[model samples]
Target: MTATAIVLLVATALSSLVPVIVRRRLRSTLVVDAVTTAVMVGFAATAAALAADAAPARGVGVVVVACAAMIAAVGGGGYVVRLVLWAGGADTRERARDSATGDGEHVPDAESESGTEAEAGPLRGGRVIGYLERAAVAATLLAGWPEGLAVILAVKSLARYPELRAPHAGEQFIMGTFASVLWATAMAGVGFLITH
Candidate 1:
């Protein structure tokens, strides 16, 4: 248990920083985005293949399941963090815009999305794809699929899209929750099979 907690703490820290590092290192230019997108797709494919082959490994079933669970947890946590950050960021940006414009009235969230680029985020694509990608990756790893992690991260990076003109906080939260739950379910399904 202690070892697992330590491992998770480390993984969470590392996973949380992936987007930041990518953004800082790769810039948001068109060419960079294109290259990063290609790399992400390749990683997803490779990770999926690795995970599929790792399932049913003798003596490693439990380890795989544990790892998958940890991943699911971290992914879920990351989703929440992303949402909070997005909300907070939007507020700050809005305030700044209002102050600059001297428009006393606050700018609607839509104004920002419609006028400027959406902030960078790891969660993208209406939650469904994100859910499937994360869940599949977790299951793949729990099944003793080698290199599943690489592909999972790759798919996540590629599939991630930001909603610039969202209507409400509830909407975003619902999407995130759905994605997290879906992935968690996938991880559970894989665990059941591995244990059996």
Candidate 2:
């Protein structure tokens, strides 16, 4: 691989690990976020420079690998956000209980606290949904289909509207989605610069 391609690949690999490091509490979220953003911006700049130099045949392979790396980074970043929130006392169950009871007290049962058994279960399939969502975003952007992002957002919002009524769920959804989309977009932008 060319030196530029090697650097881009290494940067991408390292960016994918920032979230995991933050999740492990080896670094604070603020520091991780700044580092991640800087790394992504550097990736984009490097890709742009590579593109200007006339992409080689291997650029296609690099683009594909970079795209996949972006998706992984986005997913990992979202999980990191969840970890930070949990560490910051933003536990979903606690928020739900507090909202239901109008006070921050632990309630033993969901039904007793919220008068609804449906709310008791875990937020099912959220992790899977987040992965798929970020993948779709990266794919659409890389495919030059920016308009598709609207459809993805619309579908996600509609599907999660009911659950969003809870303050904690809403907060989690917003924060997680924002982080996921931002990472995906940055990754895709880098890929675009390299490929086109």
TM-score of each: 0.34, 0.59
Q: What tens-digit string does per-residue lDDT give for candidate 1 at 1-196? A: 3233323333433443355345434322223333433443343333334444444433554565466454544444344433433454533333444565686454444323485444333223333555465556556655667477667656554544243244544445455555454444444443444343
Candidate 2 ranges with C-alpha deviation above 4 Å: 1-3, 14-75, 83-89, 92-124
Over all chains combined, what TM-score does candidate 2 have? 0.59
Lowest summed lDDT over 10 consecutive residues: which window, candidate 1? 24-33
Q: Who wins the lDDT comparison? A: 2
lDDT of 2 by residue, 29-70 (tens): 345555665665576567556755655426557656565456
lDDT of 2 at 8: 72
